[model samples]
Target: QIIEAIESAFGDGPLSGRHVIVTSGPTHEPIDPVRYIANRSSGRQGAEIARALRDLGARVTFVTGPSTTPPPAGVEVVAVETALQMLGAVQGALPADAVICAAAVADWRVANAHADKLKKDPSGRIPTLEFVENPDILATISQMQEDRPRLVVGFAAETSDVLAHARAKRARKGCDWIVANDVSPETGIMGGNENAVLLITADGVEQWPRMEKSEVARRLARRIAEALAE
Candidate 1:
């Protein structure tokens, strides 16, 4: 209701007619009823991006996993847990004008997630586990033949060779742009307040100085507005 009020109040803003879908946080793939596999994404950047878009008068659908940061106001929020759930939520939110995939999805999930917690054996025996690959949400959206968003952006968290990996990811995923950052332990960017990122596009790469994640989101939102306008 608050989101509707905001939209009605600012119907003439730059992104008024635009619809954007943003996927955030780290997806948890369950290994058992109690245990799961997940990444370290705090979902700060993605949440900030959703807020920035909403501030620009865009109708935003924020699909997120188990994020520490709360979902921003003036946007629709869809909470999910696993990679599959995130993908489903994102797809359900489309067909959006733009899609930003910032979720750090687990690469693999336990093929046989036990109904209950597995207990240790008294004979010192260990249980073997099988794995299955999770769906690539970014790639699936980017390569869509119909109902594909006009703009598709993805994020890459790399510890080394940031630009190279980011470029490869953009090509492989078929996303229009990729925001890459170094998340090495020394950089403190994984869960830090500030971030230094490289925006990789087919035209070239643009290195952005370290700044607050909120600032980055604002800049990215402006760029998105411009691109969509063109």
Candidate 2:
């Protein structure tokens, strides 16, 4: 409703000239046919941002990982399961004016995925599970040779020193901006309805008041639209 009001006030052409890319949900790293390594992301925040961007008139390409939520209306949605698949999808959805890395991508994947479920061993020896680093989608796109988005925003889920960690993430990933949040066990922010976040950029940091994820998305989308216009 708020987004609708903002769109009406701005009239047309606010974001019509731009293309935005958003990544959402948690990528599942297959461990076996019956199980996988995944995160607690529900994709509510990412979907809201995609919807808000579309409402603002931007052409949005929303890439999602394994999730139960549906894509927002009026946006092109691409679904994938593994981190590798999400990376490929993001790469294919290029020429975007902005890219929002909202997905809780697994940092590592099983080095060797099992084709079948392993049974419990009577000998009581645990099976060794090797892991390998997954591709950093945001970093790859940010450092692209050409057709890179003008602005790249990533999310840093941390427990302590959130702002400091976010700064390091921005520098490490070569992204233009990052949204930092504390996802401590007590916060329940990972898959919750509301959040308190800090928007960090090269210019400075902006601490946002606690609000519903939808509200945050709407505001962020508006900011993104304005930035593209600049």
Candidate 3:
């Protein structure tokens, strides 16, 4: 199995030494019990990353939103639904060696969520909904004072000028690294198994050949393991 291979290569040693935190899945901003704003991220990539990290000897606390994929074995998993809940969960699991903000978090949420679904009026009146910005979970964790992780990784899912936007996000978020990806409508990378990503760091941007999500997670976990050991 993939896990056995990673353990054999890295060592069967327990991840008794360090802690890691990861976030994944799409946060649902509820307009009501029946309506909500969300994204297409399946949390598959994030789950795989947590599994890979665990395989390479790191204790992982995965905070995730709703997703069909099950949480990986041998890691503490916390489930959350809204953006605020996810943020609180990740912050609570912090003081880690590293944090990966892999969730496709929503930029905005409903300002006022309805307690009950509004019924249609025979008068043909249209109901209005207000939206407000959600907290930037990645930026918040990256800038924490007391327990900031040594390395903070964020994901940039953009359509055009992916690198440019990712670099800007790196500076804006103040994270050590940003994994950039082009998720244009045609890419189908959102819910698909394959991904093409660029690792952006302070030194420079490194382009990685398109690979399976599992492969990306393995390579990335190795890189993080080496970085932590340093």
Candidate 4:
């Protein structure tokens, strides 16, 4: 109790005494000893968000996948590869003030991962791959009855009808907000530097101008601070 009090007092910022968890990057679902299914998420935005939350004096726990971008400094980093592992990490860091699910988790994983790489057949027959759905981490956490965060945020990367999809996602996932963005090839938003996002909440949707991912992180962090204050 004394340690907790001292830590909270010394935190000394707008978000002091608050804990935030952010998940970033794409999960790799193994297909074989050498192959895996993954996505193109750069994890830049999530890393920036973690930094922004930390700057606001929040104790940040960053649960991440195999991202090329380095994890942010001054935060507890839990590195994971599969969706299940990521979910476990997030659950372990729970009882947080806020939770952000920014990861591009693979929808399915190999139902029967091979222990060894299969050799090519002389008859040119291809191997049949079976898949199973992965756990919906965002939905699981958002709908938790116990130890649920006050604010739960999710990301919806869409190519068409972004806002509509995001709204449906927020409702389906039961999260407080959804950060929706276009990843259509022309936009160059995915795996790029800048992002234009729509913040969807029960109140309404707010469209943000295209800007650096870091800037978006800062703005979102400020908004989170304001919301938590209220």
Candidate 5:
């Protein structure tokens, strides 16, 4: 509701005339026709981020994975299921001012996925599955030599040593900033309403308090606007 009110009052906000691309949710890599690899992402954060960006008057192209949370108003939503399809959708919406890679994309996919569901073996012989690495969307965009967005933000959902992992990921992926959070089962953040995150940048790291995802989105959008303004 707060976001809705903000949207109504919004006119030529900070991000006016700017283009932003946001990737959200969990990419499903099919293991077969029925089975697939995915995470516990609800896509609430991504939706809120898109809404906040739209509230600021930026044109947002939201590339979302399979998720239950609905996309917010006033944004172009491109629905995709696999990591490869998400990459294609993002590339198609290129030449943006910023790209927020908030999606929890699967790292590996079933290389030799069966065409049909495999029936259970009578002798209890389990079938073996092959795995392959998915494309690194964040690194690809960050290292792009031409038409790269001015700002690229990535998310690191870690179980332990969150800061260290996030810092390493930022250096490795070459993104402008990284939002790291502990998604351990105890934290209940994987599909929860709140998030506690650390913002890691080239300058330094700042710890943000646990808050509703909507508030986090609003804060993040404002920061993005500020960074792009400079």
Candidate 6:
């Protein structure tokens, strides 16, 4: 640990010369020019993860969605709004050593969003919206055969059966690991500073204790370094 810390301080850590792509924040699916659909993500965890990776001397490509949280220093930031844009950005920054799909990308988008602001009818008639499924960023990168990253990490934000859902997700997405977290309202994790996550890998599932989001990022970053070193 001490040696690794010193190497990291000198910017020659295990992850030096490695490039990692981290997607953070929540992608918005537009319903109209003035309205959109989004998740309850504050981008806190993702930001911290990017920061941690940077501290380990890796070249970080921070692809982010619409969030107020400022990205960390010593990282390249690609700001995007919708899922499609985010997907493009990630693809453009490809061939990385690792990719962390930490963004809460919307599952669907409006297929026929109006160009102008939607007007409210005095007769109280609701406007209908056509929906289309958004691109599965995690699965796309995870299943890539030509230039797949050495490590692919995805996040599963579940309200119930966290581990079961996470394990299934890892297999389904074909990612190297899954970081599962309970974001049920009572947990206060969605927009909070602390988190409790489950690390699901081929070996087994490891449940992490609740702690500050920053600490979780640090631990995950270290693990990624070790994995890459091997």
TM, every model: 0.94, 0.93, 0.92, 0.94, 0.95, 0.95
Clash pairs for candidate 2 = none
Angstrom error of the Cα, residue 122, model 2: value is: 2.3
lDDT of 2: 0.89
Tens digit per residue, CA lDDT, model 6, 108-184: 99999999999988999989988999999999999998989999999999999999999999999999999999999
Global Cα lDDT for candidate 4:
0.91
Off by over 4 Å in 5: 1-11
lDDT of 4 at 225: 74
Q: Candidate 2, which segments miss by more than 4 Å at Cα?
A: 1-13
lDDT at 145, model 1 = 99
What lDDT tens digits, residue by residue, belong to model 3 across residues 37-57?
889898989999999888878
**lDDT score for residue 99 of model 6:** 99
Q: On a 0 to 100 scale, what is the lDDT of residue 191 in model 4?
A: 90
- Per-residue lDDT of 57-121 in model 2, one digit per residue for the tens? 88999999978778899899999999999999988888889999999999999998899997778
How well does candidate 3 score on lDDT at residue 185? Answer: 73
* RMSD, every candidate, angstroms: 4.3, 3.1, 3.5, 4.0, 3.8, 2.1
CA lDDT, candidate 6, residue 202: 90
Superpose all Cα atoms of candidate 1 onto the true structure and report the RMSD in Å to 1 decimal. Answer: 4.3
lDDT: which is higher, 3 or 4? 4
lDDT of 5 by residue, 1-230 (tens): 44344445555777877899999999999988898888999999999999999988899999999999999989999999999999899999999999999999988899999899978899999989899999999998999899899999999999999999999999999999999999999999989999999999989999999999999999999889877776
lDDT of each model, Cα atoms only? Answer: 0.91, 0.89, 0.88, 0.91, 0.92, 0.94
- Tell me the tens digit of each residue's lDDT in model 1 across 1-230: 44445446566556788999999999999988898888999999999999999988889999999999999998999999999899899999889999999888887888999998999999999987899998999999999999899999999999999989999999999999999999999999888899999999878999999999999999998888777777
Clashing pairs in 1: none
